[model samples]
Target: MTASTVLYEPSKDGITTITINRPAVRNAVNHATSLKLAEAFQKFENDASQKVCIFTGAGTNFCAGYDLHEVAGNSTGEVAVGPVDKVNGAFGPMGPSRMQLSKPIIAAISGHAVAGGLELSLLADMRVVDTTAVFGVFCRRFGVPLIDGGTVRLPKVVGQGRALDMILTGRPVDAQEALAFGLANRVVPKGQAVEAARALARDLLGFPQKCMQADLVSAHYSAYDSPSLEDALRFEFARGALVVAEESVQGAKKFDKGAGRGGKFEKGKL
Candidate 1:
């Protein structure tokens, strides 16, 4: 009911954790909650010091989906749709699903991540799922379409054939199965998704930031924006070359000095 339904927690070590707090409805994002989520993520994006984001929901669940109760109450029988501007990006019905984040965000999943919830999880660079986590296109039973990048990103993440199986059947995919499908990057014991994600975020922070971000952006472009393999290669080289002078030189020096010998990461030293 209030903006506080979405909570933002920024750590001193540069990990920002954004939580959906409406556990009453299993953390479903209503219109107001969606706006709050968008605002919170925008804040994270704007803070240069914040390097990674951990996205999760409060209580037992990740998210059920967009609040259908809100849809049920709409007098016009239509949910409000935001205007889209592909260049600058725009808010989707599920808040920041349309955003192309400069830095990586990890989804720390517990319970259901279905329908719009599943789409939201797809927004992250990777997902850390607990044993209790469940993923599905649950809105299909109600004729609700996957409007928040589900149809687009899901295939890219898990392959088109696998994506079609989930999209068409609307069957629930549990954490272990999700790992095999390449949906969940890591599966931990129940209630440890957030902690695992935070640990992974810290690992990311230990890397050379410019080079990591450059590679991340290049990967995203190759997956969604590039016209062809050659174009993707050109884009990657250009972006990576910019980072070479800025970070790779220093990283190479560290490597040469045996700072990262035997494939061991020295945390902050890196």
Candidate 2:
């Protein structure tokens, strides 16, 4: 009910759900909301029981952007406040995306994810945007800058040239364009985004967490250059070696004993 609270839930399939509940203002990140989001993410990060997370808005609109009403009132640029020295920068302490979650997260976007909202969506490992979803670097129109991870992540997700086009032109892109540009992993029917994300999360749980984490870490950190590539591989091996040490050994025994996935897992019944 208050501006500071965001919604948090652990779903039936060990899919933690973090919902932006301030739909009246399209889930704008206020100071309180930011704190709550950080807290919720903390829980997700620590819970080994949860294999995935789903972030979504409570209503039709995913997020309209920053609560300009709240932003307008801040005079803290001259003074230090909450975690950061300035106020106009991205919603630092208040964003679910600024912090990285090791477990996979799927974003379910229903409507518009503009400016900060779009930045938030970009945080997820995979995103299921509604076919009618609208994405934009909307803050440019109002002279607001993207101080969040958007400036950094957008170019990585989409190309730098495309990112520049959005930032410079402030164009609203439909879900199709977002899909084409690799901004979203999947586009679903409107109002079905959350459902699709949830289903994917459920499916993801079938995989071994250790392997998933090892692969994710390697893929994210690896580079084409020899040194960085070698370091990434070393990290991956260090992490993966533990799984291979015992867990995978036991898993192999199980399959050999007929309890393993390979033997019982028929064509596609799972």
Cα displacement (Å) at residue 205, model 2: 0.5
Candidate 2 error regions (>4 Å): 1-4, 76-82, 85-93, 223-227, 250-270
lDDT of 2 at 194: 91
Give the number of the best model, judged by lDDT.
1
Candidate 2: residue pairs that collide: 4-32, 4-33, 34-94
Question: 1-270 in candidate 2: lDDT tens per residue?
Answer: 334358789866788999999877878777667667767877898988877889989888888776777766776531112534333443363455556667887889988899888888877878899987989989888777786678877887899999999888889999999999999899999789998988787778876678777776665555222266667778778878877965678667766766645445432122
The TM-score leader among the candidates is 1
Worst 10-residue lDDT window for candidate 1 reads: 80-89
Score candidate 1 by lDDT.
Answer: 0.91
TM-score of 1: 0.94
**TM-score for all predictions?**
0.94, 0.85
Give candidates' CA RMSD values in order: 2.1, 3.9
Error of 2 at 175 (Å): 0.5
